[model samples]
Each structure stands twice: as C-alpha cells, then as structure tokens.
Target: MAPKVLIVLTSQATISSVDKPTGWYLPEFAHPYYKLAGKCDITIASPAGGEAPLDQGSVKMFEGDEECQKFLKEESSLWKKTEKLESFKGKASQFDAIFYVGGHGPMFDLANSAISHDIIREFYESSKVVSAVCHGPAALVNAKLSDGSYLIAGQQVTGFSNTEEDQVGMSKAMPFMLETDLKKNSGSDSLFVAAAEPWGSKVVVSGKNGKLITGQNPASAGPVGEALLQALGA
Candidate 1:
C-alpha cells in the first residue's frame, strides 16, 4: 500500500498590511504535490473548508516548470476540495506524515489556531514525520505535547529566515518574524539554515526522535518534497 501523507495549507486569503490576496505558495505545494502524489496517497487539508489562496508570486516563480504550471491551472479544484481541519479533529495518527505548505498567510493564522497546534502535536507524538517550509514552520512554535512541553523543544529545525523576509520586502509588514519566534520558543534545541540565500537553500531534515523536515523558502520546495518522500520511504 502507498503511504498516505496529509498536506496542510494556510487558509488565510489575504496579506496583512496590504490586504492583498495570498495563501499557500504554488511552488511550495506544487513541487511537493507532483513528487509525492505519484508515489503516495496524498490528501489535502486546510484550517478552513473552502478554497485555498495561492500566492501570486509562485505562479511566476515556477512558470517554466510544466508540471507546476499544470497543477496551478487546476489548483482551484485541487486545493478547494481540501478536508477541513475540524474534520480531522486532531486525529493525525492515521497518516504517515504531515506537511505544511507556506506563504505569507501562515504567519497570521497557522500558529495561533488551536486546531492546527493540536494536529501538529498529534502527528509528532505519533512519531510521524512533520514537514514544513518557509513560513510554514511558524505552525510549530505552538505545538504542545500532552505534557505541556513544545514538541520542537530540543529538536533541530529550519524555516523562513529573517534574511529572506527582508529580501522579499515584507520584513516589517509581517505579523511576527519566524526566526525570532523560533529562537524564543524555549524548546528548539537548535535551528539550521542554508549557507546560501533563503530561496536558493536546500531542505534540512533532522532525525530528532521522529522526523522534522524544513525548507528555507519557495526555491527549496522541490528539495523539501524530495526529502519528505525519502523520510516516508515512499
């Protein structure tokens, strides 16, 4: 049987200051979707049950990649039909792994949502792979285990770096900076970063208790997807 992976996308449809439409980055999800969908049974879910917003930048970023472009054209149906977080009811043990696709939206909602935190905790407690990219790692800051300690405590991880945020020109506009928050989380053993630019960085997977895979930015999505598949043995 093919391993089953649950993909969680940010449901926030608008950017903070500008109020521009934004959700999950297309390349962040598309690169992973194409790679994993072929080898595993993949299911999509979101905080809310309706349509997921797509980051306009990603459409241009992965434009030359035919598979990504094809997926983007059909993303409305593909992501809109996602299972609601409430439907999962924090029961994350049923899947082999859970991946969070990121965009500017995650900084606003993913960490603050009780449902998302619970889902992440459940997956971690079950020893399932927990993967995220870019701002997606924001979701981990609040994930608490049954004992009330952060699941990421003492675990090495990565996420969208402050350097990249500045490059994107959204540093001051973001709700909370991810790098600063992660460092303050008290449980993060150590955090890693690519030596190159955030977008050009590769994925980082740490074997801490379970599996924690993280990508630096949109450009790292393909590598992140490939890492997730390897972690699942898919």
Candidate 2:
C-alpha cells in the first residue's frame, strides 16, 4: 500500500495589508502534488476548510509548466475540497508524512496560528516527514517539540531568503523576513541555509532519513517534491 501523505496549504487569501491576492503558491503545491500523487495517497488541508486560494503570481510564473498546467485543468476536483486543519485531531501517526505549501499568504496566517504549530510539532516529534517550502516554512516558526525545543532548532533549513523577498520588493509588505525569522528562532541544532541566487532552487534536508526538508523558493517547489519522494523511500 502507498503511504498516505497530507499536503497542507494556507487558506489566508490575501497578503496582509498589501491588497494583493495571496494564498497557496500554485507550483509549490502542484509540482509536489503531481510528483507524489502517483506514489502516495494525498490529501489536502488548510487552516480553514474548503477552497484554498491561489497566488496570482504563481499562476503567471508557471503558466507553461506541464505539471502546473495539468493542475489548472483539473483544478475543480484536485483542489476544491481541502479539509480544515483543526478537524484533524488524530496523532501524526495517522499519515506517513505532511507537506506545507508556500505563498505570501502563509507568512500571514500559518505564522500566527497555534494550530499550525501543533500540527507541525506532532508530525516532527513522531519521527515522520515534516517538510515546507518557501514561505511555507512560516508554519514551522515557533513550533515546539515535546522537550520544549523548537522543531527546526539545530537542523538545516532553507526557505524564501531575505534577498529574494527584497528582490521581489515585498519586504515591507510581508509580516517579517522568512529567512531572518528562522535564523533567529532556530535552536542550537538548527542551521538556517540560504540559496545562492534570488529565486533560485535550493532544498535542504536534515534529521534522520531527511525528516525535515525545506525548499528555498518557487523554483524549489518541484525539487522539494522529488526530495520528499526519496525521503519516503520511493
């Protein structure tokens, strides 16, 4: 039987105070969704159940991406029924792994919700795959493990770097710098990594069998999925 994989997305539809549309990055979810769908049973969820919004920029950025295009054409069934994160009260053992999808929206809600932290912490402590990409790492912020330690502490991590945020000219628009927050909150065991170039692809995996995996930017989305597959023993 294929391992069950849960894909978490941000339901926050708008960028905080920016008046710009924001939600789950399309390719971040799409590429990963496609890559793992065949190898695992996938389910989608969000802070608030129902439909999760899409980032307009991601749609434009991956307009020609084959996997992304398939997602667009199959949008209705592929994405419309995300479960509410609060509803999943079972232990992390319920699934083989969990993935956090990114966008400017996650930087707003996922970063603030204690629910997100608990979910991520449960998965992390259970020795299961706990992965995030780009702004998706926002969900990992402040997530506490059972020993009263931060989840990403002393682990290698990579997310949307500060340089990329500034390059996009949304530094002031976001709640905080993703890379900076990780660096500041990460414990002695954590090593926050950054990509060499703005918008470049970078995936960092830490812990046993790559328990913790993160991707740097939109370009890292697909590769992050690939990494997850390997981590899952595909």
Candidate maximizing TM-score: 2
- How big is the positional error of residue 111 in model 1, measured in Å on the Cα after superposition? 1.6
Clashing pairs in 1: 153-187, 154-187
RMSD per model, one decimal: 1.9, 1.6
Q: State residue 121's C-alpha deviation in candidate 1, in Å.
A: 0.6
Per-residue alpha-carbon lDDT of candidate 2 for residues 108-177, written as tens digits (9 for 90 to 100): 8888788878888778778889999999999987787878887877778889988888988899998788
lDDT of 1 by residue, 129-186 (tens): 9999888998886688899987666666678888888988888888888877776663
The CA lDDT at 57 in model 1 is: 74
Worst 10 residues of 1 by lDDT: 186-195
In TM-score terms, candidate 1 sits at 0.92
lDDT of each: 0.80, 0.84
Model 1 misplaced stretches (Cα beyond 4 Å): 186-190, 207-210
